[model samples]
Target: MISHSRRHCVVELQALPARIGQIRRIVSAQLRHWQLDPLIDRAALGVTELLSNVHRHAQPDKTCTVEIEFRLGRLTVSVIDSDPRLPVLREAAMDALETCGRGLALVEALSEAWGARHQTGGPGKVVWFSLTAAPAPVAAPRPVRISSKPVREPARTALVAVDPGAVSAGMSVAASVGARPG
Candidate 1:
């Protein structure tokens, strides 16, 4: 039921500070290419937050995969890391003024929906966010000019022979409306 073609991109890299910025750029570029101009900023922010988490908290190593998929008028940006520990969403404390713990909060605010899921048949978990945007408008078909009039075909009736054994009784009853069987 998807009218527009879907797009997917995956980038595997060590979640270093430098690489996070690089992935942000790649995500932005891909969203632009998919004609999702409105989602670029939010998606970039979500990717940055997920990658930052991987860089700071993932175990075994800092390696991770950043995946971006667009389908059904929604864009999903996810990060998969070797750590199975899902991210904890801390409630914002009004008394605390720390700036470090606001990454996921920002992602939650900007995204339509966001969650983390344990990867099946793998050692890692994927943190993802969804953004809804209107699909790109379909281009109008070009108008063609015809120099000659369309030819008309003369109507003729043909007799069609039906085998009672070959056709079901229900089919024969339906075909008897206008069809003449010889």
Candidate 2:
């Protein structure tokens, strides 16, 4: 089996008011690249709410980081901050709407999965989420069809069978091809 990993960013959040647009742009770019724009809009909204809660409820000035891991079949976004308290999940009826208490609840409903974890060797928590299996790639642009002629298929692509109960995708791909890039 094989694993893919990527490190994203570390940013200061002393100016959260100015960071909304920046956050939105980064998330949009990543989602569009991953072909997950359908949920990008929703994720963006939820992420914004999450960040908003961090900014408002946490200390007055702090450094926060947004880390995203994007791979062939999964994406995870984590916001690390210097706060020890894990986020709370409460019924909306208990809290007034103006205090931004609904952010976590909204995220719960929108995300595939999310949670807060205490950072190792540190004094804070990392609020993170997991997004799975981006959408299929978009077909390249082409000229308009002028006739009903048959289309030519692309070259060098292979059809690999997939088993319903395969334990690992990487193993399956390697078994099918016999070998792969190191």
Across 1-182, the per-residue lDDT of candidate 1 in tens digits comes to 11224588888899999988988898888888888998999999889988988888999899988888887888888898999999988886222677676778888999989999999899989999999997678899989986998788988877666656436655663466456554
User: Which pairs of residues collide in model 2?
Assistant: none
Clashes of each: 0, 0
**Whole-model lDDT for model 1 versus the true structure?**
0.83
Shift in Å, residue 91, candidate 2: 1.8
lDDT of 2 at 162: 53
lDDT of each: 0.83, 0.69
Q: Pick the lDDT winner.
A: 1
So what's the TM-score on candidate 1? 0.69
lDDT tens readout by residue for model 2, 1-182: 11223434344454276786687777777667655677677767766877887788765355677766765566677777788888887786235545657778777777789898898889888888776755577899988977786888778767765553442654665564655334
Each model's TM-score?
A: 0.69, 0.64
**Candidate 2 lowest-lDDT run of ten:** 1-10
On TM-score, the candidate that comes out on top is 1
